[model samples]
Target: MSRTRRTLIWGALAIVAVVPIAAAAYSPFLAWRSPVYIVAGFAGIIGMVLLLVQPLLAGGYLPGLSAYHSHYIHRWVGAALVTAIIGHVAGLWVTSPPDMVDALLFVSPTPFSAWGVIAMWALFAAAFLALLRRRLHLRFRTWRLGHTTLTSVTVLGSVVHAMLIEGTMENMTKTALCVLVLSASIKTLADLRVWVIRTRRFD
Candidate 1:
């Protein structure tokens, strides 16, 4: 394919990936909601959108970026993802402390709460693992395995959590984002199989 064509295709894909999120952020229903809830809701939406980007970065799907640059962006995006999650949870807590506490304790009546909590912790665990990787002297394969496992949980749990919430996000758009997130994650994980195969050479 010509470079121009590839660029256009990737650009189109990027727009398709983000349009749902943009629509959710502008949700007309937000007019009736308080600022805190609006912040919280948008934070969650941004985090969900980030989830879709995360795997795409890892898979190096963005046009014109080298794998090294893509991975660098991936790391930064991971940090942003953590920040977004904190903003989301903290905003929700501000809106309702008791509910947030219940969610944290896994006793929230809302099913989405449990999944969000799970994904949150999984994200933290993944970050911690990355931090400790060099200090712990973990093998490359071992680190990859653990990181991938935690990421899988984070992605799946976050998708479920977001889908369950019937808040500001439009249903069809939210579902489409979830599908894209899952597809990107699965594709990246499948690519990781190459790493697994290489590990056998060392073993």
Candidate 2:
């Protein structure tokens, strides 16, 4: 990519990634919320935003990152994604154990709760697979397939979860972020053509 185009891409990424969080920080709705609730909500927002970054890094689409550095950052981003989610859930649970229980048990009256739970588990599962694929003797292709499937689930569940919530995040920015995340994920997956990847014995 040309230097100018790279700069534009990075700028666009920053806008989409940062705007919603910035908007949330200034939302009037947060004035009445508890500190734990505010922290939990922002953690979830950060986690969802990281979803947009994850696929770009995995597909090496992020500008200026070498393959090694991209993969390295991808791993660290995965760790951050997990931590943000854990903080999101743990904070919420602390703030309201009953709601968290209902959500975890799939009995929450709010439909978004189920989707959030589903996404959380899907993300955790994908992360676990990524961490243990080598120890599990998974081939390269097999690992990719499993990880990609779980990740797709995570993205789908998360987008739905986020969209369904009538919460602090601004609707316009949330929708834009969701569209970008889905478009980027679909583009990367379509480009990979993973079915054509041949699995060798050593791989």
Candidate 3:
């Protein structure tokens, strides 16, 4: 399929997967689980997976794409993932006022609440550091190290939060998603190590 077609297909699938959970007033399965929370959870999980897949997809895990095209696609995909994450968070807040307040205050009394808060903060830190990387006039190595550290913490915290939550994702799906998150994280670390080694060797 063409790149545009592929993008549309994936984008539509994402919407379809998320719409049911988002549109409902309450969860179909769990009476206590709100639709907004379920949708947000789905969005976050899908966003995480897409983020993991972006590099491979852009790098021609299938064939027939130029490097420029791949890079362009990667940029668009990254933006979409960020949009999805924002939607997830916003929907959750709109649906659950009490939970949102507790989560924001870091006093939810839920195992995942603290982790989610940490992840949210780490995300902001990473974004801010990226934006100011050049303005801060830090050395390339130092900036890179800080960026990677913050990103790792964010992903780790998010995974922990997702695992601790027992609402939308249940049993096998939850376990599989957790494993996918962990695997993606480990793969990213390995890729970074390879890049560092190659850079040092060239230097």
Candidate 4:
């Protein structure tokens, strides 16, 4: 097969694998609970997976792709991730009013709530900074430093939140998903560090 055809095939296969897992995680309806929550939880899981892939795609780790293609995919996937997280939070708010208040106050009875909140804020900050990166006259080095710091916090908080939550991601499948997400995040961070070091040495 041609390289482009092979890439498309693999990407399709990945999407296929992801769909059923998402469906299973977020069933259409639960006997005693609202479907919105389920949908949001599943969206959250999918968002994390997309976030994991964004760095890889942007780094051209995906087979038969150019850097520009990777960059485009990364940007769109990031937007999707943000949308999914918003849906997840909104659903949780609708389903559990008191819990939402506690989460906002960072005093939720659930250990994971605080982490989730923190991650949300970090994500916001990172997004905002990305938008302002050029306007802020940020040196590439400084911008990278700040971005890495915030991204690390976001990933850590997200992992903690996922692990502590007993809702959608409660079993071995979720556990594996979490590990994959963490590994991906770690790999990206390591790569970034290496890049920075090499650039500094060359300069």
Residue-level lDDT of model 4, residues 94-175, one tens digit each, is: 8888989999898877888899999888877877777688899887777767866786788789888888876655466667
TM-score of each: 0.91, 0.95, 0.68, 0.83
Question: Given candidate 1, what's the lDDT at residue 55?
Answer: 84
Query: What lDDT does each candidate get?
Result: 0.85, 0.91, 0.65, 0.73
By lDDT, rank the candidates, best first: 2, 1, 4, 3
Residue 26, model 2: lDDT of 84
Off by over 4 Å in 1: 194-203
Say which prediction, candidate 3 or candidate 4, comes out ahead on lDDT: 4
Clashing pairs in 3: none
Backbone clashes in candidate 1 total 0
For candidate 4, give the lDDT.
Answer: 0.73
**Residue-wise C-alpha lDDT for candidate 3, range 54-77, written one tens digit per residue:** 545433442456656765675576
What does the lDDT come to for candidate 3?
A: 0.65
TM-score of predicted structure 3: 0.68
Lowest-scoring 10 consecutive residues by lDDT in candidate 1? 194-203
**What is the per-residue lDDT of model 2 for residues 159-179, given as tens digits with 9 covering 90 to 100?**
999999988899999999988
